[model samples]
Target: MSGFSIVNGIAEITDPAIYENWLDNEEFKAAVAADSSPERNAVKRLLIDFEADLARMVRDDRVQEQVVEVMTKYAAWDYVQHDPNAAGNGLEKLIEHFRNVPVVGEVSPPVVSVILDGEVACLMMRKPVPDPVVPDTTYEWNILTVFRVHNGKLAEHWSTFRKAVPGRDPLGD
Candidate 1:
């Protein structure tokens, strides 16, 4: 645990505003891209072209069209999904599932950081859920998502999501 970093602990904005555009954060991108290996580069591309773009798609509700192109480019159609709340485990399912979601324009979810370990890459994000006891107040939770790169495409995915009581704190705090 010596190397583990904490986010959303002191405040809701533990991550800097630049992280919201991580791909464009030159220093952050340079630090990660220093490796320059094939697999690492592929994972970086996937993060930028697919995952980063996902925010835009969500904001505009362009789930079906743009998401398809990027998902197809970076992720395997048959990729394994470990999150219990995930829609399904295929490219088509990803598109179909998001199409039904409501558009939230550039609310700028906090993407804390991303790290790579061989074939696996982890994207850390800070999510805020409404405080159950205090209306208009909220608390933050760290969400870690891991993606495994295979054959230069995202082959598997996992996340820190769990079922919580209705209108309650997601972490049951």
Candidate 2:
């Protein structure tokens, strides 16, 4: 249980209790303190809104509203494609893939690790899950999200996903 402090993009959580304390501290209250820029607050609100929407998704096993809004927000944006034509690249296509699945299992809570360099932030997350078709098939995969945030708005983003294979124990060799 940890989170981005965002003051300088430093994330620190020594204990589960620390994160619990943070939940009660209500960091959003701190975000609302400075009243000079309403627009900045709006972006902050958007971040919170997305976070809340993600929570709802966890409960519902869908990302409909959030996906639509995010796609609209990124309209006319440049996207780097690993394989643009194959499956997912555009927001609609991404949403389609997830929606197309007969049973959309809840995505695991992202294990977030951030790399901060100046104003840029890269969040490396590992989200593992059992293959829906075969419950016994489980694997932990990596998803990296790079965000360029300026003035508190998500100006740009890049993301990629990877998976790992399991190896048999040495005694079998």
Candidate 3:
């Protein structure tokens, strides 16, 4: 097991593995859009795409062109990050932060649910954390990240995360 599974896409946010998963899976998309309007639905899709893009960058080379491409597609140039542990504001700071990190061995942490209101979207994730008291044991920690979107691109971000030890990024960095 890769310690990751989509849970049959409970909230229907997991995109497919190798194909145009979301677009071809009408039933799955409908599950996600079941109680939403067209506008809110669009925001939901954008957030999912952004999440998947970040995950892809993790599995691939962090310094490769994909970083810029993915960020450009989903983030505004004046992106603001509010994570206290993050180095500084602006997109490059965030990009540079991951440039030299070793390749991660696990997949991105699964997102439990996604919520959207107006122009703000929140991705709720149940993170896996090593149990401090019990060696080799892990626990699930709930983490919430909210983003303010502009023109369908993420502009500002806030996350519930603290710095981890070097090479110990729980979400695969």
Candidate 4:
């Protein structure tokens, strides 16, 4: 069995081997379902809505202003530090980065998980890389984002990404 359990009303995924196996394991799935308290539900909903907005932006090539509207005025987007165009910083710069850059293909919806402890929520998701810029070659990426939500809006965000080697899968298998 996957070493997933609950203690003091918090879901604990003890086994690193089963970290990515929760989606398929019935026990883990049931545990996640049972731990969906009201606060967690709200954070989940917020992430879903944010993803929908991002998808819409990718599909239409237009910025959805309402998505940022829900964010705090001083929302700290840790992901943009790697973006060259975000030199000015802040949400507007991030929006400009998205607007100026060209998206070759659709953005796939990420697999999201949320963990809530008291007033803090940790949201984790895996997103696929966009299509390659070069022809006849494919380079894939797996991006994981963890967001800290406060007051029902995104307060802080952090992300890490891994690129698949050419002619190999993300895991280099």
Candidate 5:
């Protein structure tokens, strides 16, 4: 048996191997299955669809018709009501940004998780960071994007980033 510690009433697995194994355990499956909320399920499906669209874009290195399809199906037309970041204000602007901006480095597969009982969802991943000073040394950028869901569609989005750091506690110091 692996040891775990309770931190602020949440179980913290002490070992990576144990944690990985526990992901496939029956109890874990049961717990996941017990969450039967329709909204939660819809969000999960939407996230999956979005991830597939992202994968296609990354793989093809271009935003195609499928990207628009996914966006139209999973995200609201006016996703962000008011935002300084031009890319997030509307679906058309976002697609334009995707087409114009060059992805800096290899994008890792995203890990999607639910938050706030289907009201919010998060996609966490890391990507290689370009280092101008030390080109040889590898660096990674940690990114977490949260989306607010409304009527089974993505209504709002926000993101946070940490550059070239590993094991930097995302929860804060």
Candidate 6:
């Protein structure tokens, strides 16, 4: 017979670092680099860059350099955005978007879900929500981001947002 135990109705994670390592691994990194479409690569870079920032939030802040680099790349891209916030090739809008996005000072790791179709990759992240009024507090959110790569750099990206409720409850319920 197999032994079983649960704490707070959740199984204790014996290897919590597994997910973290996977997110920061070379496999994902290589995939981002291999994305041939400029737009697609850009999207991958944004996430990669953000991943560093996120890790820093939980462990160290020096990773901001990588985040800045990613942001800079996004700023330089001359691509159209499907998001409503994006107006005219998106750099200014993206900057404004990040400025307005609330950042939790506390660690709130994201849960990533990936799906690939040909050259398009879709990544879904579920994490503590950003406070509606504060930039340093936590909330919950479900975000779906799509990227299309064409020559190693990102060429396009689109995102959808949903709010998350507390208590292990699923969002959109």
Q: What lDDT does the true structure give each of the candidates?
A: 0.61, 0.42, 0.63, 0.48, 0.52, 0.48
lDDT of 5 by residue, 1-173 (tens): 23444334233444534333333343422222223676565565566457555655645566554567657877788887332333457788766645653443333333323345447766543334456689677464455677888887778877663332333323233
TM-score of structure candidate 6 = 0.47
Worst 10 residues of 6 by lDDT: 1-10
Preferred candidate (TM-score higher): 1 or 6: 1
Kindly report which residue stretches of model 5 are placed more than 4 angstroms away from their true locations once superposed.
1-34, 81-85, 103-107, 126-142, 161-173
Which stretches of candidate 4 lie above 4 Å from their native place?
Answer: 1-35, 64-85, 117-142, 161-173
**Top lDDT hit:** 3
TM-score of each: 0.65, 0.42, 0.68, 0.49, 0.56, 0.47
Model 6 per-residue lDDT tens digits across residues 32-128:
3335566545555555555545455334343333444555553345544665444335555555444443344434344344445665767655455
Better of 1 and 5 by lDDT: 1
Error of 6 at 3 (Å): 18
lDDT of 1 by residue, 11-37 (tens): 224344543555355454444333447
- Choose 1 or 3, whichever is better by TM-score: 3
lDDT-based ranking, best first? 3, 1, 5, 4, 6, 2
Per-residue lDDT, model 5, residue 106, is 32
Stretch of 10 with least lDDT, candidate 5: 164-173
The CA-based lDDT of model 6 is what?
0.48
What are the RMSDs of all candidates, in order? Answer: 6.3, 9.5, 5.9, 9.9, 8.7, 10.2
Better of 3 and 6 by TM-score: 3
Question: In model 6, how large is the Cα lDDT of residue 166?
Answer: 29
Using TM-score, give the best candidate's number. 3
Write model 4 residue lDDT over 1-173, tens digit each, in one string. Answer: 35746555344545644434433455644444344466576666565456545655555555445335433332455323332223345666655544544443444433345566654555544433345687665343444456666666565554442444333323222
RMSD in angstroms between candidate 5 and the native structure over all alpha carbons:
8.7
Which residue segments of model 3 deviate by more than 4 Å?
Answer: 1-30, 33-35, 100-102, 127-140, 164-173
